[model samples]
Target: MSIAGLLIRRERLARAWSQEGLCRGICGTSYLSKIEQGKAAASEEVLALLFARLGLSWTDDADGALHAQTEACMEALFGGDAPAFAAAFARLRAQERTLLCSPCAADYLLLREFACEADGERRPLDAEFVSFLDQRQLALQRVLEGRHEEAALLYPAAAIRLWQGAHLYARGRYAAATEALRAAYDAAAAEGYAHIMMNCRVYLGNCCSDSGDPKRMQQHYAVAQRLAEALGDQKILSTIRYNDAATKIECGDFAAAYAYFSALEETDAMSLHKLAVCCEALGRRDEALTALARAEAMLPEGEAHAPERQMLALVRCRLETPDYLHDERYGTLLTDCFALLRRERGAGYARFHLKWMLKWYKANRRYREACALLEDFPAEK
Candidate 1:
């Protein structure tokens, strides 16, 4: 890895920033690209300017997690032996988790990262890696159902740990949230798996934004966006863009948010939802409705009742009637939709709305809908 990657990552770690965070800044990523390749070669004045805003640089001699992770991150930059670093990072990470599924779970994240990057292509290793992920997911199901207080004591419980971190961040718990994601990221990035690595960064940025940490948000966003761009995966990149836009909306850059959301219209689902939200946020309700309408038109009839379509209905519902109770029929529809999603959208497990229906129906008088959901839900684990 060149000095640019080192410096950029260094600054990012210092501020506890993520890619979506950095994307919020005026810096954009073009300058970041130059820094990573050592191509920009900023003048003394430019270096001074950076230090003022982002703080000091390593100049090849810095210490701490930033420097150490910088070295590890650099190895991945040039396409070296990723698993070595990934495995090493996993060992250290496994030791720190108060609750975990052991080192294998940590290794799974690393392996996922390695598989995502073109440089770390090795099939047998990938199969072994995926097996670990499958096991880890199973382990997670137990934790989610178990009481949270009981869980804090489990050793090396990686997935549950991250899930808790996500929960805390969403609920506005910044410091604890940071600690969790940072630990997970340190372990996973060492593996150099593109998807997991980027994902960790994205969630970390989400934490920062929720905490009102704009600078931190920008840093992580920048790195995540850069990594996604490097991986050249359209789907993942689009996801990063949607996330970045969401952060900007929170920051109140309505115009910029508008552009970011508009860009999503040209992409896929995450983009579609994000674009609709952005339009709605800007009081361009008509634009938002039209975008969702076009997306709805694009789907085949069978998929019209899919989660994506139904989620759009929720957003549309939000505009027409904000109260979950106002749209009395919505509870039934949402229960039915999530039931359909639980069967169809394999990755829809643990989604936000999945349990919303279950809990609401149980508490309120929607027992019929809840019963229908249970019966309609495909009998699968």
Candidate 2:
């Protein structure tokens, strides 16, 4: 440990202090432990008190604690040396802590990010909206730093449930995701946090789709679409529409599924995939390939890559149409499928889907391919 770290520790111990002792009015013992162990950083107010508790001069600018964080936030809102609007908005948020619960916190966060983005106003919107966004920025900081649980502050109701469900889904815990998302939906139904509710519903639909619970997926999309319509949120409505398209495709409503996606201004990945699936269902092999290509193009690069893209790649390789042929292009599709099958990390429908694919190949007189797939599949217990 550095001398400063050692001094802090010695002074704390000399006072017969526990990590919990330092956290009395500020945070939790576990929180303090992480800080003292260098796994976390202490807030300025806590550090000021720590010095005072050690009978030392408390001569420090308290904002000094969050100074770097504020600077980084500004940089995020304004990267260039140009004037930063986010700084002013951030200052307002910091100065008026009461702004935390304001209705426009969302707008403030948007502005703050925009300030970094454009280094100027991006759009002509209302002042109330900006103020609300400022509060949201502060809330995000607290949440990211693990202070949400400490302060008992919550996310925007819709975002809260959406994130909770998303987190559970990432952990392969679908049941928990369903419960969290449903709570969020229910809460929104009463109070109308429409945009957030739509996001939550989007995530809920995704979970249900993977679980093969198409009914829940359809229901979520319906409710989300209704909420989006009420809010006049076209973007989210597009998402819900695309999800509904996927559900339609699953229900074997190929014509309706195609029409649904064709109507959307901005179709999502699942929509593209579903559109492709519709083409396959209609025996339009060329169109199906194009839709699959479109879906692949829509897959975001790097870590944000959607898992469904992998699944779709798998389908392209193994899923056969009498109209389709085995060639180098088909080989690429097969390779993509194998990669997807190898990386099927989630439970429930993943293995089941692969099993069904294998069965489909065999039933179609593709014995060689079925044997090849069986070679890679886990031996049945």
- Best TM-score among the predictions, by candidate number: 2
Report the CA-based lDDT of candidate 1 relative to the real structure. Answer: 0.54
TM-score of 1: 0.40
Give per-candidate clash totals.
31, 13
Cα error of candidate 1 at position 190, Å = 5.5
Report the C-alpha lDDT of model 2 over 1-381, residue by residue, as the tens digit: 111233355567878988767668766778666655545666556655666666653333334533444445544332221233445555656643322222232334444444544312234333322222334454444433334322124445444455456556654567777787777667766765455566677778877765667887788778777876876777676667665666566556889888876666666666677666677767777777777888888787764354676666754764454433434454455445545544544443243355445655655678898787665443221
lDDT of each: 0.54, 0.56
All candidates' TM-scores? Answer: 0.40, 0.48
- Output candidate 1 Cα RMSD: 21.1
- Candidate 2 residue 55 Cα shift, in angstroms, is 27
Report how far off residue 298 is in candidate 2 (Å): 6.1
Residue 128 shift from truth in candidate 1, angstroms: 24
TM-score of 2: 0.48
